[model samples]
Target chain A: MVAAVKRATQTLLLAVTGAVLLRMAAGDSYLRYVNSWMRWPLIACGAFLVALALLDVFREQGSQDDEHDAHVPRAAWLLFAPSLVFFLIAPPALGAHFAERAQSAVVPVDTSTEVDLPPLPEGDPVPVVLDEVLLRAAYDDGATLADRRLELTGFVSRDKAGTWFVTQFGMNCCAADATVMRVAASGVDAPPDDQWVRVVARHVSGTGDGGREEPEVVVEQLELIEAPKNQYR
Target chain B: MSESTRQDSPPSTSGSTARRAVGLPVQAYVVFVAMAALVMSQQWLVPRLDSPALATWSTIFVAIVVQSIPFLVGGVLLAGVIATLLSERALRRLVPASPTLGVPVAGLAGVALPGCECASVPVASSLMRRGVAPSVALTFLLAAPAVNPVVLVSTAVAFPDRPEIVLARFLASLLTAVAVGWLWLRFAGRVPILHRRSTHDHDESTAQAFLGSVRHDFIHAAGFVVLGAMIAAAINTFVPRSIIDGVAGNVVLAVAAMALFAFVVALCSEADAFVAASLSAFSDTAKLVFMVVGPAMDVKLASMESGQFGGAFALRFVPLVIGVAVLSAVGMGWWLL
Candidate 1:
């Protein structure tokens, strides 16, 4: 009876976890947690798990494996936590909430070595990553962004001083290792916290001053926008 | 723990009577209560997550778990293959007879397994059981998760411009593994490494055994991964960077801090490089310490090592590895990075 119950629980755990992975991958919801490269791998993992569960179900009854199954620790059942979190809370992508708590300013870079940055593209409002704008402001030796009007999109985050900024997380692997990149906004009232927005702004000259302060931008145009499908850049 | 002990015991007369009376085993009752609570808690719990901090924490927590699953699964499957296909006779043919030579060879052999440290514990334990030298097996355990190609590639990717960081990590991790092996050999006479065979070694078919091993390894390792992820997520969420940045100026404190941080995070080696890369305030040498110390010895690895190699062995081994790993990283970082 113990063996039978163990088998059933094992099968149930595998199936439920697989289903959660599949559900996450079936849509863009997975982008909330991991990079796009992870989607296919997650799908494959989900399928493999379901297949394993099916195999367990069809395996011969009272098999020799069942006698040895008693050794599996009860702690193994804690594997359900991820599935439980996914199905229940379904936390959204990291946004202003994380950016505010993580760091109020843009991620710092080495300033001793001057960076020879390339010029921005030929457009009145050249589309640029919000973090790249901050980087160019902080590190670029040529002052490439001094006169340029750049279009950036990010959620609104405010520091303790009530200075609001447009911010996005630059993820290396996943949200777990995400670093913040934010550009301070000027000449506009702050939007509601966590509100995603697009802005056509000019980099305020001398604000970044070689990474000492966050690069500030003068907002010429601002528009409320929905958060992108993949929030991390 | 109590439940596990109960499961191991034979069905007593009272247990049988209890099963008849309840119409289900005690295990079933426990599982039922847990599942019912989990399902019932959803509605009550979901709405209370109104705080953005809590939401952010949950997202990062799930993200770590989600990002790790594929690699963990891959590791478990490969471990399953190794368990069934590899034998003691085959292993004996491969490893050198001389313990001195075998230790370094075993360290080099770690490059073959591309999984995290979680996957290496079972494989290393099995290697010892298959008649390999304890020193060699321990070396492989320390090295496999650190120097594997997957981990190196991820390191290279994390520090795209700093090719030297990858080289430093490789050298430091390899040096740590080999150094520990030599130390273990020297101290083996005094130390007791209790080797317990797996509880059930059934004469089952190869395919069946492979599947069973896969199931067991996956369930066991994934559970530990969850535990590690929860701790890591909590640290990431609550621990402000100002506290970490304060020590960046002092080299000794910086290296020690990074080593302690790595030990607690228990991140998969493949993903740790990204984290180290993100900690831009630290010196290159300090970051290298984080990378080297993490894969060789961490919180989760210590627990898993204790579970596999016995609590006595882990109690001694954990500190020894951590010390050697820190020294190796500092040495290599000084030389390379």
Candidate 2:
């Protein structure tokens, strides 16, 4: 009976976590945690986990390895918590809370070719990531961003002084490595914190344009939209 | 904690009578009730999760767990394959006779096995049982999880712009493994590590045993990983970032702080690079210390060593390796990184 319970717990833990990742990968759900590149591995491992669980379930009943049951093994029960968090809570993507806590890695002002920054595209409202907006503002040559109406999408983040910034994070591996980037915006009604918005704005060359401090984005338009399927850039 | 006492206690007459009265095994009934209540309480918990601290904790916990599942599966699969394909006698022959040569050889051989510390535990125990030298077996145990290809690739991905950090991690971790193995060899007389399990249980066929071991390893490792992630999340969320930010500017202080952080948090080697990357305030070298020290020694790993190998091995070995690891990480950070 102890053997049966052990087998059952292992099966449930793997099978459930695997299925959750699979479900996330098949659609937009996985984007909440990891990037799209991880989808195939997530799906493959999910299937593998389910397969392993099934094999464990159907192994020859009497073929149990004759090792004695260990301690009460309450520890094994903790394995179920991850699956519970996934299915029950399935918490929203990284929000303002994490953004405030995780300091943005300062992008150096070198503007060297090594940063591999791409050329800004030509459009009335050129769509770009918030990281790109901050990068070009802080590091790009003045003319590249001069007079261009760059657009970016990010959730609202507010500083202590009641000023709002459009911000997003770029994940190196998972949400844990997500680095926050923010471009302060004004002249638009404040969206409540954590509400995703697409900002159509351009660099304003004024007193604050030292290219070292908070790079300002003149908010020409602010349209509230549902958060993107994948939150990280 | 005494497993022998918990082993299959045959259902005596009274045991069945009580079980019949409850219409279920008491153990099963208790678990079932607890799970039901826990799941039902989600309604209450979900409302509170709106708080930033709670929500942040939940997200970090979720991320770490999701990130590790693949590597955990991979670890078990690799261990399972090794178990299914290779017999004890066959593997023992691969090592040299002299423990001196075998120590470094086994340490380097770990690069071939891609897994974490938990997977290596069972593999090392089997090696000891097969009459392998304890130094060689212990070296393989430490090295297998740390220097594996999967972990290195993840480390590279975590620090994409700096290939040298990856190189430094490999060299430092390899040096630590070899150094610790030699230390074990010198101190073998003072400290003896008896293999935990003693018996012949190969009666089951290879396929049965292979799947059984896979299930066994996955359940065993995943439980610990989940526990470790939860503890790390709480530390990550509540512990002021100021603790880390305070010392980021000082090289010596930063290294010490990150090393202690790695030990207390006990993150998995595969996913630790990501966590280290998040601490961008710390220099790349400090991050190097965190990575190098983590797989070789951590609070959870120490306790696990005590559980499997015994307190004598764990108590003595942990400090020796920690000291060696800190020195090697600093050395590599100065020279390579």
Candidate 3:
């Protein structure tokens, strides 16, 4: 009778946990947090637990071997104490301290694309760059080529002499394997480091030098925005 | 009259029944709950901490667990098939005789069948039941996971800028496995627990044997994996990153910390290189230590050793492996990295 109760308890706990996790996985933001590989084991373990619980409920106790029983050590319960304390008091999120201490590896930039810039409207405040025009051209065939207004979204990566690259980190695996992608913007107000923002810019692509290639994007406007929950690409 | 006399053997019948009663349900229950609790704890603790360093740690942990599942599944299935289907004569033929040859050969052979550390325990246990030498089986258990191709490839990928680190890891782990095997053969005395069989018998048919063995190995291994992960997650949550980083630079301190990290993280050999790579703050030597010691001696491996080889044997064996792995890593790091 005691064994049956224990088995039922286990089954209930596992079912509840599995259902919660599955719901979490099916939610829109699930892909942002966990990968497909992680889901399989949890599902498998839950299934196994349910199977065992059913077996325990129906199988004759005397016929079953002691080896098949669920006997946990008293010491195992002590393992839960630390985790319980932690769940009650959540730790702080990753901060600038990590960025400061981590090795400053430079992100390699590719500079081979060409862009064409339209003339800025009379009395326009911001200067135009070449790369933005190329980016616009690539995606939209330079249609709706507006010298009046344009917009882009990314994080402030670096600030240099009136220019900054709005950057985002792309991850292939976990956060450990993240790589940075950036677009340079000039003539816009530079945001604080690592701040997420949207920028409105005049699209301008630079003409290739006779022997040199320098494609740039000139930003005409900048607006800072709130950081997303997950910062990785 | 002769048959009637033989039927009066009450003592033998009762003795066998008592042994069965004592062994079966107790082992099953202990193994099951232990496994369940351990796995569940890992699931709970990994998400709550949320530090970048912890994120890297969690990735390594997950990768190790994820990568090993296929091999573990394969090994358990194979064990089950062998146990149930293969005749005693066939099993004997399959296992190499002569401990001297078997131990070294098994250690070297680990390179060919690359798998994660989690799979090695069950495979080694299965091999032992099939008549492989304990010393050789132990050597393979230590070496195969450390020096397998998948692990080495992952290590290479993790340290893409440096090719030599991969080679260094392979050499150091191989040497460590051989050394552990030699030590075990020389000093280990009459260890009966290492060879204990709970329910495996030669009489079982292949199909029944296969299913039983697979179920047994899966439950046993999965339980320890969960236990280890829980301990790892708990440690990850409570222990500050600064504490790990504070002692990371000092040579002696770094070595000790790496050894402890190996124990705490319990990452698979293939995935550990990536974890080491992400610890860019630590010296190359420290990272080397992390790679070398992690697969050989960690919480999971210790739990597994205890479960397979008995608590007493594991108590002795784990510390010895830790000591040797640490020293070898330090020496190799100084020389190579």
Name the candidate that leads on lDDT. 1
Model 2 spans > 4 angstroms off? A1-27, A48-67, A109-118, A140-143, A204-214, B1-26, B29-45, B116-122, B148-164, B188-200, B264-284, B298-314
DockQ scores of all models, one per candidate:
0.43, 0.36, 0.08
Clashing pairs in 2: none
Backbone collision count in every prediction? Answer: 0, 0, 29
lDDT of 3 at A140: 28
TM-score-sorted candidate list, best first: 1, 2, 3
Model 1 in CAPRI terms: which quality?
Answer: acceptable
Which 10-residue span in candidate 3 chain B carries the lowest summed lDDT? Answer: B1-10
TM-score of each: 0.88, 0.83, 0.62
Q: What interface root-mean-square deviation (Å) does model 1 yield?
A: 6.0
TM-score of chain B of each: 0.85, 0.80, 0.78
lDDT, candidate 1, B59-115, per-residue tens:
988997888778777876776766777876786789998878999999999998777
Q: Please give, for residues A112-166, the per-residue lDDT of candidate 1 as tens digits.
A: 7657788898998899986677778777532888778899999999888999999
Error of 3 at A141 (Å): 32
lDDT-sorted candidate list, best first: 1, 2, 3
Fill in the DockQ of model 2.
0.36
Tens digits of lDDT, candidate 2, B1-337: 1122223334453354344445433454555566667668878867765687777787778876677677667766766666666776677678898989998999889999887676676677656766788888889988987899988999898787789989999999999999888988986646878554321235555776677666666666566667767877787678877776798898889988988888876667777887777576688789889998999887667755665567788888888888889899899999986
Best by DockQ: 1
Q: Rate the local accuracy (lDDT) of all candidates.
A: 0.78, 0.72, 0.58
Ranking by DockQ: 1, 2, 3
